[model samples]
Target: MRRVLTALLLTSLLPLIAQAQSYSHTPPGHTGLGGMIGNPSGLSLKVYGTDPASFTAYDFLLAYDLDRFFFFSLHGLYERPLPDSPLNYFLGPGALLGVREGSSHANEMVLGLSANLGINFFTERFEVFLQVTPRLHLIPETEGDIGGGIGLRYYFGSQ
Candidate 1:
């Protein structure tokens, strides 16, 4: 009698274990905060005769991938993303309010608006993404620019 009862209990538990393992393979809704390090490209003045120059800008972003197709990111970016594909992919519209200090420019507050788009890849807990943002600066000078970078994000939630 003892052996029969033990065997029945083991058989009942096996199905529950199998179901849990199957669910583990699917990804859950994830969001994260991360930082990125990349050079800023597409810094150009719109004036016909103005000379073109470039700056190395860094950015820190807070991102929420609402779903696979829709995402929202708030960036503390120094510059903007460029408009192009393949090489300069990931462009979206965004805004920035920060201070700038360069070799020739004084320490001043900057207000900028930008647009961007990008791609994202994810595992259960790790996420990698790349994006580009085209921006227009309102302070110091009114100009058009582009910036692109890659980032890594770690998800936090029930896995």
Candidate 2:
């Protein structure tokens, strides 16, 4: 009776162990902290077609990928993404707290809201994406405009 019971227990545990080993080789989900570096470029204009201007800039972003395609980012953006593909795109609404250094106006705190849309490609350790974002600057009294750039993202966690 002891021998039979021991054999049954081992047999029951084998499937569970094999399942764990199989999943161990697969990559985990995108729900963790990650960092992105990219260039940003787009059009800027005041509300109601006031003071329309265009600028090119660079940006660095720190964000969390909520899933395979969705992300929430806190980015220091300088340019916007290009508008070509609409299905595979990147876009989000975020606030900007920074200065426009080279403008004719004095350097001051600028508050802005932005939305981006782009596509993402993922590898084992990194992700590359392109997106376009439009921003509205409130404090500096600049018109809201569209911007986007190519971005590279690196993931740090278990594979």
lDDT of 1: 0.43
- Each candidate's lDDT (Cα)? 0.43, 0.41
Model 2 weakest 10-residue run by lDDT: 42-51
TM-score of each: 0.49, 0.47
Candidate 2 lDDT, tens digit per residue, 35-149? 3322232222111111225212123343322111122224332223235421133334566655554345455555677765555544454444456666676776777755455
lDDT per residue for candidate 1 within 86-113, as digits (tens), equals 1222233457665556456556655777
Superposed model 2: Cα runs more than 4 Å off: 1-89, 102-105
